[model samples]
Target: MKIKRVSEFVSIKRTVENGTDEQLLAVKAIIGNVKKDGDSAIRIYTQQFDGASLESFTVTVDEMAEAYGDIDKEMVLIMQEAAENIRSYHQKQLRSSWMTTEENGTILGQKITPLDSVGVYVPGGTAAYPSSVLMNVIPAKVAGVERIVMVTPPNQNGKIPAAVLVAAHLAGVKEIYKIGGAQAIAALAYGTETIRPVDKITGPGNIFVALAKREVYGDVDIDMIAGPSEIAILADDTARANEVAADLLSQAEHDERASSVLVTTSESLAQKVAAEVAKQLAELPRKDIAVKAIADFGAIYLARDMNEAVKAVNELAPEHLEVITENPMELLGKIKHAGAIFIGRFSSEPVGDYFAGTNHVLPTNGTARFSSPLSVEDFQKKSSIIMYSEAALKENGAKIATFAREEGLEAHARAVEERLK
Candidate 1:
């Protein structure tokens, strides 16, 4: 990791803003072909990219039973525990449909309804992320989603990961498919002969998956166009250098494009943390990925003071923000943008990623500036409810009519006028 002065670091833009239109176009073409050609396109893409010859894309119930038998009992227990924690957290975010009526017979409220069906895309290319299975499915289940379907790429042997199957079973997902990438996304967005269409899609994948979601946004609801994982640490002189370095490396090991940055006012601390990172990288199993990530996107900035450090963090709008200052609580109010905020030395990123009972599927690529972490709210839709009595309409109808007429919408005014009469 290289140390840069705060002035220079502040002037540089975060990497999230540099998306290419070429990638978007390529993704759009893939999505279009899949939507138009259906399973044929899916099969061709699956064979071309995944090197699998699949007779069907859907995973059968018999295969799920086989997966359960193949998986270890201890792993099942762990998945149960993680699923319990995820369910408990999302249960708090469950909302009820409500109605309020006044004495004047005017009723107004909102109806919260769970989506009919939702699709979860779990990546099977690199490794199985059973954690993501729990995070995505539990929220929709808690929101009362009727049908929760999961799609993941099958291995060369044409089998889903046992861990994924166990997690899905724990999360109450009855439907699982052996398909992935842009084809799976297209199948979810537009129904194929075998795969049922879904109302929404959620989960993270590579650039191809992100681009496919961007293309299918109009067809169905999507969580967010997630980019690479990133973590920004704001530490003061009181913070430990080794601990900060370890936390930074935790996110760096995720991918080669992942970013880990540290902003602090202490010059000695910066040097110490950089040295500690070098030492730690050697011991990590994913050292090559971490080293490349650190070399390209990671940085340790020496700020003049804590205020400057916080300012740079806010501008960065990182997916994960760690404040390891002596008084992390005091600076909490100053943070304006972050997908998830971890305060103090004990609150590490993996805590939220695993057992902390918060969703780890957070906004990335500085999208925390406008987006939010995945929650039960993503699985539910709100419909406004308005019921005005004759007297109530008489009282407010003229105002509504006037507003409509001012906007040159006579039909809207007449509708209100007719209702009042």
Candidate 2:
């Protein structure tokens, strides 16, 4: 990791947006074929990519029960606790339909409705993410989504990970499918003979899945076009080097493109953190991936003072931001952008990733500059509610017609004008 002065650090936004043309073409072709051929296309792609010959894509209730029983009893208990925490946290985010009545009997408000069906795309092959299953599924359940379908690549033996299936069941998700990549997104976006189309898709995956989500945006709503994971720490002299190093490595191990940064007022602390990162990197099981990530994207920014450090933190707009300073919450108001903010040294990034009761599926790259974490709101749709009494319309119709006429919309003007008569 490089220890650079904050003034000398260059922005890496362009590097984060680097998606290849070939990947786009391949993803587009996969989505197109899946849209055209349905389950048959899914089977062909599953065999070609996942090395599994799947005659059926659905995971039946019997299979779900068997997977739940197959997992260790202790692990099941832990997942149940995690699911409860997730449900409790997201339950706070559930919205209600609201309307306001005026003196003139005019009524206007927003109607909050959960989607009829939603699909959660879980990534497979490299890792097992039961945590993701809990994070994505619990929020929708809290929002009262009627049907929740989960899709993931089948293992070589045409089986889903037992822990994943168990987590889904714990979170109250009954529909599970063994299709992945662009095909899964297509199956969820466009209905197939075996799979039903969904109103929205949420969850994270590889570049191919991200591209597939990008391609299927209008046909089906998606969470966001997520990039590589990133974390930026803003600290002063009060922060510990060992804790900081561990937190940075936590996100770095996620991908070679993942970024880890430290912006601090103390140059001595900067040097200490760099040394600590190297020391901890040597001890990580995913050392190879973390090493490349740290080499390519990790850095310590030595700010002249705390104000400058805060400036850099906001500029990066990292997915995860940790404030390990004398008074962490004091600076919370100053932070304008971050998908999730962790305060104090004891608040580690991994806590939010798994059991801390916050969404781990966050806006990556600099998308944190404008977006937010996945929540119950992501599974919700809002419709405007408007009602006007005859007297209220008579009072405002001419004004509305004149405004429409100003925009050269004759029909809109006439629609409002008709009410006047």
* TM-score on alpha carbons, each prediction: 0.94, 0.97
Question: Lowest summed-lDDT stretch of 10 residues in model 2?
Answer: 10-19
Candidate 2 positional error at 302, Å: 0.9
**Residue-wise lDDT of candidate 2 within 242-299, one digit each (tens)?**
9999999998998898999999998888889989999999999999999999998888
* Model 1 lDDT per residue over 1-421, tens place: 8899888885223455223788777677778898788888888888888888898877778888898899899888877887888899899998898999988899999999999999999999658899999999999999999999999998877888888988888899988888898889989999888788999999998878877887789889999877778999999899999999999999999988889999999998899999999999999999999999998889999999888888999989999999999999999999999999999989998998988789999988777899999999999999999988878888889999999999999999999989776
RMSD each, Å: 2.1, 1.4
Model 2 TM-score relative to the real fold: 0.97
Indicate the residue-level lDDT of 11 in model 1.
29
For model 2, the local distance difference test gives 0.89
Over 4 Å off, model 1? 11-26
- The per-prediction tally of clashing pairs is 0, 0
Q: Candidate 1: TM-score? A: 0.94
Q: After superposition, how far is residue 129 of candidate 1 from its true place, in Å?
A: 1.0
